[model samples]
Target: MGTPVLFIHGLWLHASSWEPWVTRFQDEGYDAQAVGWPGDHDTVEESRRDPEAIADHGIDDVVEHVAGVIRGLPELPILVGHSFGGMIAQRLLGQDCARAAIAIDAAQIKGVLPLPLSALRATLPVFKNPANKHRAVSLTAEQFRFAFGNAVSEEESDQLFERWTIPAPGRPLFEAAAANFNPHSPAKVNTANQARGPLLLIASGKDHTVPETVTRATLKQYRHSEAVTDLETFPDRGHSLTIDSGWAEVADTCLKWLRGQSL
Candidate 1:
């Protein structure tokens, strides 16, 4: 196999949503695989049939899951993650176990203070109920449109939602919501690890879930580290940039960015 490239999908989207990206990366001669969170089913129908397996998982649970997967790989791999998955990649990268990482529309990590209203509204489905902390929450098609597909059209957004949506654990959202106040928050990443691999943070301007401001704030957290960290923004895109009609454009950008890397 060529260099290992691990794909991590965020909440609400099944791991299979990265199928396109996995195929694309493989075509370029990299060995790629997308690993799901704990309890994630192999397919959307299976996941939908039993959401309990995918519920109640928090940020630390996911990070540890991916880390265990890495320990089984032939070598340390490049981590390419979206949304919460991206945040997971950052945590793993800090452990010096990855070659590099690309976090696209990643969730807000600890120390990132600017909480955009759109982000809060996007997560309102889970936050509205304090008890949801231990439950799995699914987004309605309309909520999906608002949080992910707003940059695209009504038709495509609905189609995407129907094709890829799944119920996600509310625990991570609750943990992240109070990360700033929690001393031992699982949402924290070791941004000061100077020996960590290169990191590429991607942000979409129109994203309601993880706004550009959040990504920028995330970058500020890495300032104390001498490690390589870069930020890229797509001004016209939304949170769905990774799984939308123009996924190839975003995928290509990521591929091009990696060309400069020593890997």
Candidate 2:
């Protein structure tokens, strides 16, 4: 059997956001599972109504959540995550909990420079509101389109905005923004750990939330994994690369990369 693959979704998204990728992986003979963050709702609408429930979820909580899922598997799984999930994947790898990891359009690690204008704009709304620091906030359709669905057709974008967009916890974002300077922050990942397994950092060239420059800067953290680190860039994709129209291509690329690894 192929190695197990565990998928982690980004902020404002549920495990169901990975439906297409999960199906694709399973068809290719891999055992796949999409685990939710603690207190994450099952649906977008449900989450929207109770955004506060997810507000306090921090990086440590997510790390423990994904780690628990990994422990349930008989073999070490390939951890795949996007945005916040990608951050958690990095932390998991640092702890030596996974056989392989793929971080797509992930957030910046400590010490990365050159934050992009697009990323700053995308985050302004959340950070501007002091209340958001301790609360969850749901984006409007327009906000969703700009942040996650800009690359898709209007119809598809609208459908995705309606179907997948939800309220997201704000604490993690606040914490991540201050991660580099805060020694007590849990959002910080030890990406320089040499013992961590193989890692693939996928950068979406057109991603407004995580610009290519920032992604490249983030690579420095993995310098210790020189022999095992691989970077791939998808020029036409956005932050929602895994759910966009060409999601299969991205998933296939990751599957192929994992196949070449020892795990």
Best by TM-score: 1
lDDT (Cα, tens digit) per residue for candidate 2, span 1-263: 67788999888787898999888999988899898887788776677777777887877888898888898889988899999888888888888898889999888876776777888888876888978887877777777777777777768878787777777888888888888788877877777787778899999888888887877887876776654888999998888788877888899899889879855
C-alpha lDDT values of all predictions: 0.94, 0.83
- Residue 256 error for model 2, in Å? 1.1
**Per-residue C-alpha lDDT of model 1 across residues 58-111, encoded as one tens digit per residue:** 998999899999999999999999999999999999989899999999999999
User: Which ranges in model 1 have alpha carbons more than 4 Å from their true place?
Assistant: none
Q: Return the top candidate by lDDT.
A: 1
Model 2: CA > 4 A from native: none
Going through the candidates in the order shown, the clash numbers are: 0, 0
Worst 10 residues of 2 by lDDT: 218-227
**Using Cα atoms with residue i matched to residue i, what is each candidate's TM-score against the true structure?**
0.99, 0.95
lDDT of 1 at 29: 91
